[model samples]
Target: MNKGFYFERNLLALSRFDPALCSRLSGAETTRGRYRFIESRSGESIPALVDNSGAAHPLHSLVDPRREGKRLISTLGNEGFLIIFGLGGGFHIEAALEKTTIEGITVIDFDIHGVAELLSSREYIGIFNDPRFRLLVDPSAEALEQYILDRYKPVICGGISLLPLRTRADFSQGLFNQAGEAIKSAIDMVSADYSVQAYFGKRWFSNIIRNIAQAEQNTVPLAPVHSVAICAAGPSLDAQIPLLAERKNRPFIIAADTALPALISAGLTPDAVVSIDCQHISYYHFMAGLPEQTLLFLDLASPPLVASRSPRPYFFSGGHPLTRYISRYWRPIPEVDTSGANVTYAALSLAEYLCARNIELYGADFSYPRGTSYARGTYIRSLFENKQNRCIPLEALHSAFLYRTPLFKQGDENNSWYYETKPMAMYRLRLEEKVRSMKARIVVVPGMGAPIRLETNTGDNRTADTLRLFSSGKAAMGALEFLAQYRAGINALPLLQGPVYSFLTGLSKEETIIFTTLLPAAAALKRSAPELDTPELFDAVKKYCVGELEKLLGIWGMR
Candidate 1:
């Protein structure tokens, strides 16, 4: 453990934060066959790995590992989060930490034993001392996926990229490949969500302000129920409607927005309906008269007009980051997992939030059965029919709706053919994961789409007599006051005339939050204009977001 003064200083820094890790590293044992130090041309020693063939392979350059590391990092251009697949000597990780633009880095490597051996022989305290660095050893696909989902935030991180050490990846090819695919899966999932955020981030902030008046009421927690039925607008609902109508009163019925028309047509009444989409297209779902006694559960980011449609509408926070900030800072509300990206997913979450013990999913086909896009009496059919002309008949419109997107066919014609798409598949997978996590008897009725399997009988049913209230007291500041403070904060942000890093570092807490509201949009702008420098990007993002907010304030006449 004899290292240079600078290296010893790095270990001392790590010891201050993680004494346990330092003690473990001190006790670690490494053999020559496992790891050996190789001196560079600059007289700096680096660690190398020994292979099964008794050949030594340096983890870094014999000339200068630091130089090689910087070269590798330069290729990434600008990114907020970096995922390194190997922790060989920690040279690359140390280089990444030097970049101020990189907010965080996650290092994952296979074989914790081998990593321990390498740590024993090398001084990696420089890499370990960084507050932004995280280490994961011998992680499973599930563990890696969860870590990425939990740590990476597209709005805050801006962009994420993964880099793998070819030398080390080649040794544990199987594990590294699995890790790569898992990371890719998580990225794809996050990208889909980020796309949504990019489109509606500003709208979400505005919607929260508009919905604040509605959400100020005390949130009502649900009374425990023995059974609940979640109704979706999938094509299978055509047949399931009769059974649902028969047992409508047996279990509490929660219908998705799209399923409201189908359920109403079937002469059934649902106890509650959930809607999460912020787009105006969602208004069509409520074209039919809402049931008087039925409650409407709308995401705080939902279109403002949607809340006015129902007398007993309850506003809840969804996946929007702005809504999250409002929930934490202004007032808290019950949150529903809208990550499923569909109304049915939100409906199921509402049911879970209600503590339903026996939850049965109806019409959650999540596919096109026999090329039927929706149930028999959904709003689409009538809307298409009304819009049809001599050139385009009602049947033709229906056909076009079903054929709009190419679908993956599952099952044979003898049984039933179901069509699936990437979005549908992702939604089903997310729902399956949610069902497995919930400790309830969740059942998905046989449908025309891919089958959903959930782990049942975990025996963790919630039996609370009352639901937790989201808004316990009046907000510390009203919407107008909050908007005024936010406006001042946005206006006070440092101009992009200075260095990008300096401007970011100089931001006050309020300015930082305001800046967060701009990142998703900034990322979007950067994607479209890659030629823009960091300062130019920051300028554009700040100007665009602040201008938009200014317009909103002017329109509201609140300033």
Candidate 2:
């Protein structure tokens, strides 16, 4: 068979999966500088790259490339996603696709001309035809990162493994290294997000559904302010109260839920309070009673009991998929960044959303100073005090809270020390990262906890004098009516007639939106019942969600 026939077949197969890449390859100029085809001992064609010194480096073993491919792929353990850094001959990718456990495979390589040459040399239609396989040729670091972030669903794809074709990667070492870094960064973000979803998926759904009624009535928009002060519940908050109180009326104070009680105890009322936790324990922060005049900025997934604390709470959409769907379809709620996974970070996001020019952060200590878990008057301290007995003193309770996770003792240049758990350290790092991109000027008040290093200079203090907190779009219908429509949409979805991936990919735009709203619930269900297969899980989630929606509709009618 002519090589041209092989190229045409491969191009046709490639077009089915990635038309953009196929078009690029079709127009790409053939380059013959590095790679040359040679016959292996098995009488199969193999690619070898020639260096400047005239040394030829074969991508695979000259004896048996098929065996070598199997050996290389066998080293990876049960990872669902395979990120191959270099694509040389497609043998390893074929081997990867053979494993049922591998859900997806992405091949990243530099130089479109090189990839075009490979396609012309031999047939790769077998690999290209596989639905799970994709080729990203000559992608920039940002493009690769965004692709992984969008395509690699860790929930469906259990784990990720990166396989590098050593010889091919060595040829473009710098580019490959950048690709590796991008992949690692994307994986870290996806893994963190997936873990959160697995744990709070059901809770978030329940909370959002329960709060729909409140969200409909509480449509009062908050007016943006100029200067804002955010109060966290770190131990440093105890001493920072006086400073916060001095400028209480001067700058608008936005207190984190944990810091709300402490601020009120010091006779300082915040202009607004932000809460993001989906757990029921979040209501403890409001046990101290929310000030009637102060506005409440609650995440759509916040406990409904927390929403009830305020006469008309201001609901904002956090990073939940269902909340985002609601914002798009049900109503357009203001989106607040809660990706940092901590209330302090969410508070900063709320400040930015309010269009503040100069933002001052008080009690934003991201660690426990002197083994103090929280400032005086915070809910944790009071809860512990109430539970303490003869055997378990308040001090012991505090110590237990501080030592719940592995602690890393850290100190600043001023010799002040604090203890940080892994989660706290991550939260602080995430906040610092967020600060670098923020438009508002961030000023962290000095404290005894771990120092927050702000690398960027304060941003220009030119923000709008006032902005509306919520979008102009109102809910299309009442809460019960919306739930009825949503439940109907879920029911209208086609039954699973094929594989899970095919069924998902075949969904229309509106269907996709409806399906996406159920992902968190599906994640939660999967965690509780790991034995359920993908199709079974989808059916179960659909049934469970529809039933819940029905229950909500019934309750609304009774009321």
Candidate 3:
């Protein structure tokens, strides 16, 4: 076939898959001297990159390029999202598309001109036509990271792996290296999130549905405060209590549920308390008795018992898929950032959402100082005391708790020393990262534990004049009505008949939203089963979600 015919056929095929990419290729001017087309031993046209040293390096084998492509793909595991660093000849991508176990494939390459040359030289229509394939040309690090974050769902796509064409990647080592780091960062976030979902997905769904009734109850709106203090149940809380109490009512105090007992025991009642844990163990934090006038800010996924503790709990969305769905379709609940994966972070988010101009973080030490885990009056201390006996003393139990995970020791033994586990360090790092983006001036109280590094902005710290309160807007319908509609939407979804990708692509906007809402639960289901294929997993999720909705509807009917 002529070069014109080859280019046209390829562009036509790509247009059916990615019209935007096709348009770019159509308009892209192919730069010469970068890559040259050569005939392989198999009589197939292959492109070879011309290096800066005046030498040409073939991306694929000179002989039997198709066989080489198959070999490269065979080396990778069957499950997960595949990220190809260099588009090369597109043979490996085509091979990857044929594997049903590989959920998705994204081709990342720089230079639109180089890509256009490849498109013009040979046919990539087969790879483009596959629903599983995606092409990102000359994407910025941030753009690449965001794309992976948005599309690479670990629950649905499984794990992620990268394949790089050595010759091509070597040409742009710095760019490819940056891309690798971006991919790693995105994967770490997704994996952590997926791990949480796998454990709490079912519980979050259950809690959210049950809390909908409590969330519907009208609560007093909190006026935005200029200054706020967030109390976390770190080891330093015991030492920080006197200073915290010294402030009195000067600043609005928002206590993490874990720190509520410590604050209460110190005769300091925070203005509000935030709780985001979906586990039943979160109930222990409130066993200290919630202050009567203290407002409760509970994540929609928190245990229902925790919500019941407050006279009128202020329910907010914690970025859960189902809660977001509820906010959009049923009620507009204020969203709080719980992405830090800790209650302390959630409290900070609440403070920020309240538009607090100056924020003080007390007991924010994200480490175990002097082998201490929590504040003196926190639930862990009391629980350990209750469990201790002659054989296992309180000190022994404390030591065991402190040494449960791998610990990294910091600080000088002569002054003050602390041990940090992987999770605690991660929490600190995330909070530090979050602080850099906040409009509020963050002040971390000096503590004996691991020091928090705050990179607050020097610019104006004031946020919007007015902030949104929890459950501010009226719902279009009642909880029961919303559930009924959601149930019907799930039932109305088109049956999965063919490839999962094809089925997903065919979903209407409304249908897609409904399906997206079920993803977290699907993650949990996949974690428990793992044997269920994509279609079977979808079927299972639909049945499970529908059952829960029906059960909830039945209970609501009696009420």
Candidate 4:
């Protein structure tokens, strides 16, 4: 608003603060060596100091003492003003005046009365006379920040809010948070400046986190599991605990979070804990006091807050693409496709892969007919009302991704929704449908001898108690191991197998053949490029194969 002070830096941009405004308010009071404050009838008083002195202050090099003494000159910097809640003796003002090219500095304190006392001291005289600084001497955090916003709103708009809060009880512990948000919003509305980010010291640290699937899948040899059980904390697990305990030595035990506390109370410790929840709020039911050290099958993209607290955190990912990071870096486990499965489905997927033949579905009830499991750590008594829409309309999609009528959108309202479905009747109908489709021998051992008939394929599935837990006297490797063999076999005869490989990995049949044929000789490639050793070569091969296929297909031609 002054001749030199522009609201912006350039003609089109706001000057840092307002160089012209600093010069216009010079009609205060000053001397060549010592400055003094002259109180106007309108009750305006400011210390006169130097501006553009070409000399820095002895005590404070930022502002210099000026010959005229009405304004202290300083430069616009990462920090613009020194906010004194109580302007004491004008020492803050004099200290600030020993600089150059400053737009202005606002001082708020309760000691305007101290101005008279400061003028008597020659030490504070020269810097206090500068008009570039306005000393209000007000005393309120709200008032201080608000006044700063009102007067220097242009400069106060955006920056990392740094508040060294000093209080008796620290009630203002969250003040920086409240003020930072307001300032950021004001800055966005005012002008384009630095992109400001708000950080609260109380960002919240939890030794216990709710639900976030942090899975890290890699090509690790599958752990030997002669007999395997995917344990859930369902009421039915209570009925089967006796049987499970009797033969616990024979099987590898994996328990879902909820089942751990109870199962452990029964003198059972699981080898691993499987968590597959995107919802974090109600995850406490499973993880309230979980141990710090345990094998965790966690989602890779789960909130860092969840795994940060874990003693030894390994990751697994279910649906997130970023999950591969866990596999590439840390030891990982597979993220089983759990679209249509409940606890039983997840349990079975683990069991079958572990080579357990007599896989029994324990308490795989999809409905919460009663209000609760009649036990501790029950997550939900019934499904939320909105969840009805999930079952209401269903449409199938090709590939592993399912298109449920209402998708479980991230940050959606249903993330933590834990209400049960309509009733036992609806769940029974769907269960029958799924069981009939799965080509396996199934038996639903009813609790209390209730006749819960599960109609499976009308034939006996092979029952083999002899499970090969090792491959050639080594730890058994499952699907991932076979993938390498399949790839190498195709590479040896690309043209013949190209189409089939393409179709399998979602590429066209022709592309499959090309990819197969072009698969570079592994040992030869490594020898040609020293960097392409065992581990690196496999990934390189996968990458080159995918890239060639993608390029041939073109962006538009991709599936």
Best by TM-score: 3
Error of 4 at 364 (Å): 2.8
For residues 509-559, could you state the per-residue lDDT of candidate 1 as single tens digits? 656666666666676676677677666877887776667667666777876
lDDT for 166 in candidate 3 is: 83
Comparing 3 and 4 on TM-score, the stronger one: 3
Better of 2 and 3 by TM-score: 3
**C-alpha displacement of 445 in model 4, angstroms?**
3.5
RMSD to truth, every model: 3.9, 2.9, 2.4, 25.7
Which segments of candidate 4 are over 4 A away from where they belong?
1-220, 248-250, 286-288, 291-294, 305-314, 320-333, 377-420, 423-442, 448-453, 457-559
> Could you tell me which 10 consecutive residues in candidate 4 have the lowest summed lDDT?
197-206
Backbone collisions counted per model: 1, 0, 0, 72
The list of candidate 3 runs beyond 4 A from truth reads 1-27, 462-471
Please provide TM-scores, in order, for all candidate models, with all chains considered together. Answer: 0.85, 0.91, 0.94, 0.34
- Each prediction's Cα lDDT score? 0.75, 0.84, 0.86, 0.39
Q: TM-score: which is higher, 1 or 3? A: 3
- Cα lDDT tens digits for candidate 3, 1-559: 6667777888898888678878888888765657988889998777899877878888888898888999999999866689998998888788888787887889999988888878778777778788878899988989999999898987777778899988899989999999999999998888888888888888888898889888887777777888888999987888887887776567888999999998888898988999999998999888989999899999999999999998789999999878888899888889999989999999989888888888888898898887788888899998998999999999999998877788898889877988888898999999998888887888988888898887555525745455555445688898778888888999898777655566678888778888888899999999899999878888999999889988988877831
Report residue 115 deviation for candidate 4 (angstroms).
96
Identify the candidate with maximal lDDT.
3
- Model 1 whole-model lDDT (C-alpha atoms): 0.75
State the RMSD for candidate 3: 2.4
lDDT rank, highest first? Answer: 3, 2, 1, 4
Candidate 4 residue-wise lDDT at 414: 35
lDDT by residue (1-559, candidate 4, tens digit) is 2322321112112112333423422322222333234443333343332235533112111232232122322322434334333233343355455543233455433322233233333343233334344544323455545555444422211122221212201322354444445445544433321111011100110111112122212223454454456566656666677777788354566676557666666666666666554446425544445554446555443445556455555444443222332232223435654433244454455454455544454445443223223223333322222233444521111111222122222222433222234333333454555555443455554432112466544523354334433111122333233223333433443222211212234545444443333222332344355554333554555554444334333432422
